[model samples]
Each structure stands twice: as structure tokens, then as C-alpha cells.
Target: MVGHTLELRGSPFLQEIIREVPGGERIVHCLQCGTCGGSCPNGADMEYTPRTILAMITANQRDKVLKANTMWFCVSCYSCVSRCPQKIPITDIMYGLKRISIREKAYQETDAPALAKTFTDLLDKYGRSFELGLASRYYLFNRPLAMLKMGPMGLSMFTRGRMSLTPTRIRNVDQLQAIIRKARELGGVS
Candidate 1:
């Protein structure tokens, strides 16, 4: 136990995670038990399971951990949190990893970041997500050729009334914006 503690103390990556993420201090208690990974619904799809990511963090594999597609694959269902014996906030840590990845531009290969930015931007602007607008903006900005190919599917959805061209603002958009702004401030998200 003493040796493990010394190793944890020496890991700058682990310290960074503990400092930046809420509930991250519990990471040191992880037993390498695979419960968190087993509980994840999308576990198979992730490049690295939650357990492996935690191991990577402890091992100070900063580049591998930050650049992995594991965090982006997390659906934030909190299943891992519910099942973890150490009470680690696995989902929350995934979110923290995502923020760090974005800030560092470590996710250059995936379009998930661009899609997320477009979705959040629309949410901030309209207080609700417009599916058509979201898809249009995401594809137009990130994958223009893909947008051309999606024309038929988009038209089909529009014809089926599954999508609307115009965004619908919430009745109290100002209130929503105020809450969002305060949350950003508190989270230091800018």
C-alpha cells in the first residue's frame, strides 16, 4: 500500500485529474475491478474501457489517455458510477477527459468534437436543439461532401415531419441563458 501511494503521488497525470475533476480523488481507491467497464452500456464500443482509462491515468500515460476515443464514446449514463465499489464518478471523469481533450486538440481524428460544438452552440442560441439545423451546421462545417449525400435522408425526414427547418426557442429563453451562463461561470467553461 505504501508503494502504491508513493507511485500515485508521483503521477502528475493522476494529480491533474484529481485537481481538475470533481470526485476524482476517489480514483486512487480503484481496485482495477472491471465493474465500471462491465456496467457501461457502450463498453464494447469504447477504444478503452473505464477501468483501462483509470489505469492509464494512474500510470501517467497522458497522451494515450487524452487521445483515446474512450471519453467521447461515453454516453454519461452513470452506470459505472452506480456500480463502482470505490464510488468513483466514472462518467464525470469522462466528461473531464472530454474537456481536457478539447482544450488540447487531442481529438483531431474524430468529428464528435465538431458535432458536439455545433449541438451546444444551437442549444445556447435557441435554448433548444433544432435537429435540421444541428445536422446542417455540423455537416456543412465539418463534412460538406457528406452533407450532399445526406440530402435524400434529410428530405425524407423533413417530409415525415421528423425535423423542422426553424428552431423553436423556449418561452423563457432569457432565463435559460442566465442559468447556462451561471453554470459556465461556475464550471469555469467560459
Candidate 2:
């Protein structure tokens, strides 16, 4: 039988994760119990499970961990975080990994990153997501032909008042932008 390992001594990747995520320091307490991975709704879709990702981090497999689709597949449902015996913030670690991957361009040819960027941009601009704008911009740039196929659905949604043609900014958009700016500054993200 194996016990929990505490080998966070020399891994720069682990340290970076600790710094990047809000509660990532708790990751060292992980028991590798596979609870987090098993609790994940999208674990099967990921190239690596949350448990394997943590092991990779301890092993300092920086390139493989960052390039894997594990982080991108996380839906931030917090199922893993809620179930972990060590109380590790697995979902937040996934977010930290995503930030690092985007910063390092460690991801391969996946539409997740591009879609995330578009969603964030819209959120930052309008203080909320503009679904129509998001879908239009994403499909227009990512899959041009797909946009044509979506036109009818988009029109139907707009006609039914389920979607809006233009974005409606929040009353205090400046405040929201300020908050976002401060977050970026503190995160050391550009």
C-alpha cells in the first residue's frame, strides 16, 4: 500500500501553481487518491486526469502538463474540489493551469483557448457575456463555414427574443473594467 507523497521540494512547476492559483498550496496535501479525477464530469474527455496532472507536476513534467487537454476540459463545476479528501482546490488549479498555458502558448490546435479568449473579451467589454457576439466572432474566425449554418438558428433566437443583436453594457462598466484590470495586474497577466 502507498501513502500520500509530499515531494514538493524542488519542482518549479509546483511552486508556480501554488503562486498562480488562489488555494493551490493545498495541492501538496493531495493523496493521489484519484477522488478528484473520478469526481470530474469531463475526466474521460481529458488527455490526463486531475490526479495524473498532479503527479506530472510533482515530476516536473512542465511541457506535458501544460500542453495536455486536461486543463481545457475542466468546466469549473468544482465537483473535484468538493470531493477531494485533502480539500485541494482542484478547479482553481485547473484555472491556473489554463492561465499558464495561455501565457506560455503551450496548447496545441484546440478551439477551447480561442473560445475562452473571445468570451473573456466580451465579458470584459460588456461586463457580461454577449452570446450572439461571442458565437458570431468565434465561428466567423474559427469555422467560417459553420457560421453560415448557424445563421438560421441565430435568426430564430433573435426573433424569439432569446438573443439580442447588440450588446447591452452594464451601468458601471468602468468599475467592472477596473476590477478586471486589477485582477490582470495581480495575476501578472497581460
Candidate 3:
């Protein structure tokens, strides 16, 4: 991806992220071979591809890296992680960047953050995805018109039994909550 060059500087941000993410220290081993970029499904839409993000981290471009939308664009598919010659946990690193961005409020107003927050809230509450609830809450704030546009499709899905009207609760919901709590405590994805 063509983008602005970032100047190298001291960044406690990068060091903190590396410490938080498992295998994040491997970022220094990136070959800049574009393997992660090539493997990313949404690479074309990112301001910086995974490879470039690694380069930015190495260069300690904390402000630019945190403000960029590349981390939010990641779908967490792990294609880059599996394809990386250096075996960096690119997906986990993306999550770490996301957490930092949210914490710092460095990101621009975008639907991706809202969507992630909605999904996480639903998961925390129900121990499973509540699709209808997610869509309602997400579109309610992000794009009210999209809700109207999706009405027909949502109706069709419900009629066709493709969508459930009621959410299904897991039997071991307490166990799920405990796991989620532990992960949060360990600085895993929230």
C-alpha cells in the first residue's frame, strides 16, 4: 500500500504493546516481504497493511499507528498470522493496537469501534451473539438509515427461519463469564 513514511522515534507505546501481546516481540523480525499484506483479505482497504503496521511499530510511530484505521479494518481472520514467515501474532497485535487506540481516544469517529464495542457487550452479556440486538444497537447509533434498509431482509430471514427471534443462552454462562474475566485480566481481547 502506498502511504506516508513515518519517522523513527522513541515510543513507549510500541514497547508496551509488545509486552502486552503474546509473541509481539517477533515484530522486530518482520522481513517486510509483504506476505502478511498479500494474505490479508481487506488489505486493499487498509491505510497500512499488516506488514507496514509492523514497520511502523518498529519505527515507533505511535501517533500515526494509533490513529490509523488499519488496525480496526482487521477482521481477525488470522490469515496474516498463519502466513507470516516470522510467525508474528499479527491478529493479536491488531487487537492490542485497537485497545490502545480506544484507551487513548486517538482514533477518528468510525463505525468499526462502535461495532466492536457492541459485539463485545453482547458476548459479555449473553455468552453468545445476539444478532438482532447487535444490529439494532449498532445501526441505531452508527447508521439509522441502514436499519430501515435492512428491515425487509431482516423480515425475510425471520420468516425463512434463518434468524432467531429469541437469543439462546449457553448452559455454562458463568464459566464463560469467568473465562472472559480471566482473559480481560490477562490483557487479552475485551
Number of the top lDDT candidate: 1
Candidate 1: lDDT of 76?
A: 86
| Comparing 1 and 3 on lDDT, the stronger one | 1
lDDT for each candidate structure: 0.88, 0.86, 0.83
Give the distance in Å from residue 35's predicted Cα in candidate 3 to where it truly belongs: 1.8
Off by over 4 Å in 1: 1-10, 186-190
lDDT of 1: 0.88
Best by TM-score: 2
User: Which tens-of-lDDT digit does each residue in 1-190 have in candidate 1?
Assistant: 6687767867899888887788787888989989988988889988899999998999999999999989888988898998898999989889889989998998757898898899999998899988988888898888999988999998898899988878999989889899998897897532
- Comparing 2 with 3 on TM-score, the higher-scoring candidate is 2
lDDT per residue for candidate 3 within 106-134, as digits (tens), equals: 88856887888999898888889999989
For model 1, give the 10-residue run with minimal summed lDDT. Answer: 181-190
lDDT-better candidate, 2 vs 3? 2
What's the lDDT for candidate 3?
Answer: 0.83
Model 3 misplacement above 4 A: 1-11, 178-190
Model 2 C-alpha lDDT per residue in residues 59-155, reported as the tens digit of each score: 7899999999999889999998888988988888888898889989998877888899999999999988999899989998998998889889988
Worst window of 10 by summed lDDT in candidate 2:
1-10
Ranking by TM-score: 2, 3, 1
